[model samples]
Target: MKQSALSYFQYPEMVLVPLILFFVFFMLLLFFITRPKNRELFKKMEKMPLEEEETNNESIE
Candidate 1:
């Protein structure tokens, strides 16, 4: 008898690959979130909304 390609993944072992990939991706996301960043850049971004057009022009000089 002939078997289809889908039959290969029916075994229980196929579950491990996806689980490991999910764990690795999750760990990478956590690592980036916990990592340190430039404080000055964040301060500039925070003040952007409050600054007016005149101050924006002066800063360009």
Candidate 2:
């Protein structure tokens, strides 16, 4: 039987490289989310629904 030519990415173990790349990107995303610079923005977004409800109640009064 003739042998087949496989490229670098065609190897099963080569899948690990992409997996590691995605993990690194995930860590970067977590870092950005937890950074202090965005803290106030996250807090305001967290309270957005409650604030909207308060305004709606006042208007309905």
| lDDT winner | 2
* Each prediction's RMSD to truth: 8.3, 5.7
**What tens-digit string does per-residue lDDT give for candidate 2 at 1-61?**
1244534335787789999999999999999999999999998999887874533445644
Model 1: per-residue Cα lDDT over 1-61, one tens digit each: 2367566647787799899999999999888656668556767888998787554445644
Report every candidate's CA lDDT.
0.76, 0.82
Give the per-residue Cα lDDT of candidate 1 at 16. 95
Worst 10 residues of 1 by lDDT: 52-61
